[model samples]
Target: MRLRTLLRSSSAVVLAPLLAGLVVLLLRADGTLHPVPGYGLSVLTAAHSALPYIAAACAGSAAWEGGRLKQGRVFEQAPARGRLGIALPVLAPVWLMGLGGYAVALVMAAVAADGTAPDLSRPPIPAVAALLLLAATLTGYLAGLVLPRLAAGPVALVGAFWVMAFPASWQTPWPRHLVGNPITGCCGVGQAVAPDTLWAAGIFTAAACAAALLTAHRATVGTAVTAVAVLALGTTLAAGFGQRMGYDGTVPRAAAELACDASARPRVCLWPETPGRTAVVAQIRTETGRLGAAGVPVPAALTQDPAGGPDTGVLGRTGELSPEEVTRTTAAALLPAPLGCEQPAREPLLGWLTAVATGEPPSDARVRAVLEQPRAAQSEWFRAGRDSLTDCGRSGVR
Candidate 1:
């Protein structure tokens, strides 16, 4: 069969409108779009989350195409191409159609970001969708070869949907993270898809596709045995990759790697998408200086350090923080409340710090009383309360 003839087939015609409708529905349900930075990633995440439905449709369409081949008795006609050659023409356009859907979807997602350019780092999500389409289509083809088309089409669609959707609810990491349910919307301006997780999923889905191809092309017992062995090996290898979650926690490291502004004192750095970084940095520095002047220890640098631990006093997630919010949060960090204390008096130093950060006088009577105490008494209050506070009452800064 000529490529042109196959391209003009009924399968492509039917799938065109179906895919368009599905994509439209997905866009409508994609919820409100925030105008924060990393607009590209948020759009990609929405697209990634819709893959199971797209893949389900692909599986059904592929099964129908397979049935058409078997029903026409293409094998008996013995066209110029053998079984594999004939099947290739029937399958290629549909697979390409599925890939085309992702391309169109990527464009729509970019538009949905409301003028913000999405990160074009080529996330592994589209590749994952492509591999899943191949796996589902090939599996459907194998079924179509055995069962009648009427039964195979629906079965493959439902089965593929279940395979993709059910694992999302699984508690185990292998099924939850590796089973194709996207850990999407987690990647923001400063975050990325976990490379190890993406690689493992790619390996797993590729193995499944290969096995389906082998089963559809070779019916021999040896081929079947080999396919099962390959699948098992792939599964074992994927399991050993040790991915704890489907997506990595967002880190400011990606932003730090980008162009950093060092003009501010204490040299505050931020992600490109971080709103009002200079203002927030200035406010934080001022608040930290106030803390220091009040005899409270403050970190010299106020930056987002990916590797910094709790004691490092790292200011984080500047994209979400306002300038005043940063001031308050930084003040709290400099003089944090003790946990689980039964002390009756409010911690005067912390109240004063909060008052200074927010430009408000301390209102509570106990806090007011504590502020009137001598400097030594206030110091003793700070130290004594630190030990007396249990794990529950963390801060008395209100």
Candidate 2:
């Protein structure tokens, strides 16, 4: 078949509308356009959002091509060209359509990010999506060869959709992690997708593609045994790695070199990408000063870095550095770290401290009454509550 003729008859016509719908969905959801802050984040978001549609299209198209070959009795007459050689020309357009859609999605994401340079430290999400698409195509082709011509395309399409979409809703977190879908709750400036997650998805999808290709080429008993062994090993290794990941599929990003405001007491440091660095630093300093004046201890240095030391205070990596947000975060930072056990008074203490630091009335009646005490007595009560937080062995507000 000529390349032009194959393309003219292929499922690219169907895929165009699907890709357009995806674009429209994204645009409607986001509303206004602003450049995404990081390169890795843009790639991750684009590839994940495009995967289901592209995978479904690829699978359906491949299934149709496979059915066409079966109907024409091409396999029975095969002595002129190798099976792979014959299949390659027929499947090439389907592969091109899927990859072309993915490439367009990536380009759109880059444009949204104002063409930011790639962040090398992040996992290769775009490559993972490509591999998964190949797996979908092979699996679909295999299904078509086995099933009736009329039923093959629709069945493959639904099966592909289910494989990509249903795992996300499963109660078992590990299965979702291995499906090559983007991890849930991934990626703020302070966090990245766990490497284990990428490894699992990569291994499982690659193994699936290999097995599907081998089985499609030759359905011999030996080939079946080899395919089963490959799949079993891949599943075992993928599950081993995936089970270690949390439901959220993210981990604290390694600390990067930060821009610091050195002159302030208790120096303030922020990621270089942070907007309005001077205002953010000043707000942090002002809030920490309020905590100190209220007789609450503060960390010697405050940082926005995820990997900051135990003694160092941490600020939020997302959102605007508004005064209220700064005061709440600064006040919370002064609290004792979790002792791996419950501290009964911790909530009340945090509420009281945040109220005091923000110069707002305490919400709890008990906290309000404590605040009405004489200055010396109030200080004593505050000190006692603060101490109780670090000592899980201790109890009570007084």
Candidate 3:
């Protein structure tokens, strides 16, 4: 009897949303810009993540309405071994049903960042988090049946909503990486807090979920482990790594391998490489001028990989910067920040970068020599003075 109740209730709850969510997924995955059904598709795509748990709650409700399945009426009266085995297995499908929507959200989030997702074929954290949250919410819904229908359903809905909303501000490292986050803004999935390694967070979240279920089973209903609840709290209190919440920041993957030594100044590493080289090198000279002006020497290589770069107080190689980036960097190097964009925005720094990135010659090659050399005051560029390279104008400069 309990078996019939479980089967019927679970099927009804999961199948309905599964159908709806599938439609949403299909329409979204289908060719671009269709209509009508396309409208439903878009709406669901937006809120589809929270739908699965709602379905699960409805399943719980269906079981309750079955009368004999409610509370311990029929299931508890059955043999404990068979009952436990059957009950445990029932949880698996709903968790899985939660997956489709989870995948959609995760993928979309990644695409939103970088305008493309890396081929990160690792296990999905958000899906697993969704399953865990769904399972816990089911427990709450089932146990709270004494509440009115309006109250009961709303609990699951609100829960799904909250789970979707909160994790972003708290961007904890491992824990946040383990779960699907709803608060990520338009910023893409891993854009804000990508994990250094998926294995750590994935394994732990799985273990935590298992422990939650096992504890609930062993201790009886009212004594259920507060594992999920506690985990949520922990998520709230967690801090980001270094400064990025444990993520290595938004450094592009291509930023690796950019380097420069004291003898050889680093410049942009590019595709068909040299196209960006002239502009970048010139910008570096301009950028170094800022430090020199302030009496601090700057390096020829303004390369900086926000995630991994030389500790030499230089920007380090952020791989190759485009002509545009060269211009920007040159400007950044020349002027001190808290830049006043208020006026037409003419600053030495801005002019420097603009000149370099735009393929114009820098103001002076002599300045370049001085700036690139370790000794700020002694380099040929500085000593030869600022006017030596009238030809530096078209070379690159702001």
Candidate 4:
């Protein structure tokens, strides 16, 4: 088929609308954006999630076109151009259209990611999308050559979707990691797509492409053997090295590193990426100093740990605190230990500390009574907080 005839085909007519609808669906499905989180990363992730479907559709379209050519007996004509040359024009339109769809989705995602910077260190997700598109179409073309026209299109579509989707469902790390959607949960500001996961995905898709290309035009025994070997090798590499690191998003080590105010009497450290870094650090330093002056045993330095979680670390949620909240939170963090899981002193100890920090102790009599205790006795209660918080059945608290 000539270029003009190919462009004017019904299959080509449907490409634009299909791409547009997919892009619209993806943008709407990206969900709500929370401030101060990984806006850029999330947008990219949404694009990554949406591209697989588009690639699959393009592969199906390629199969349909291949069927049309075979039905028309174009390959039997044996014209000046070789079989691959004729096939190129037919598949090129689908390839370009698929790429165009991805480009549009990526740009839209970038717009959605506005106001937040993405970690530039993230793996090249677009590269993976390109490989998927190529692999899917090549495989589809091979299917069209072998299967009936009606069967080829749907088979290619469903087959491509299954290969991409099934791996994501497995509980095992290797399967999910090799599927190319490594970071499943929302990409928070502190996270980056793991590099090794992307590499595994790339290798898998690239190998599939090699196999598909070899099998598309010929089916010799040697070619069949080589194709199978290539595919197996790719899967092995993906499943093997793919799991060297966990598929869950990696915390950017640099972002997690403490950024501290050195001049403060009790040094205050915040996560490097904490929003409002300067103000948050200054406030924490001031509150920790106040607690220390009040004879509360504040640590020499307060370190902000985002992964430490609210009740377990010295500081957490620094990006989301008000000045007053900081004072109270800092006091809670400075408690001799995290609120213990055990009882006895739990409520009373928390009450005493809250009153000390806020000057408004809880109205509960149990809490008030702890506040009314002598300073030395109050100190003992504070010191035992960690031990009490420890889970009772485990190794006894140190």
lDDT of 4 by residue, 285-369 (tens): 6555655555667666666654443333366445556766676667666644543444555555555656676666587786666
Number of clashing residue pairs in every model? 9, 0, 34, 3
The deviation in Å at residue 391 for candidate 3 is: 32
The lDDT values for all models are 0.65, 0.73, 0.40, 0.68
Report lDDT (Cα) of residue 189, candidate 4.
46
Residue clash pairs of candidate 4: 38-189, 340-389, 341-389
Off by over 4 Å in 3: 1-9, 12-68, 106-118, 124-151, 166-215, 218-266, 269-304, 307-325, 333-346, 356-398
Q: Is candidate 1 or candidate 4 better by TM-score?
A: 1
What's the ranking of the predictions by lDDT, best on top? Answer: 2, 4, 1, 3
Model 1, runs deviating above 4 Å: 30-36, 246-255, 258-260, 309-312, 316-318, 335-352, 362-366, 374-398
Clash number for candidate 3? 34
Better of 2 and 4 by TM-score: 2
TM-score of each prediction: 0.83, 0.85, 0.51, 0.78
Give the better candidate number (1 or 3) by lDDT: 1
For residues 195-304, write the lDDT of model 3, one tens digit per residue: 43233334444554554545435545543446555545444333222234353323232344343333344343322222344555555555455445544334344444
Error of 2 at 80 (Å): 4.0
Residue 78, candidate 1: Cα error in Å is: 2.8
- Tell me how candidate 1 scores on lDDT: 0.65
Candidate 2 residue 234 Cα shift, in angstroms, is: 1.1
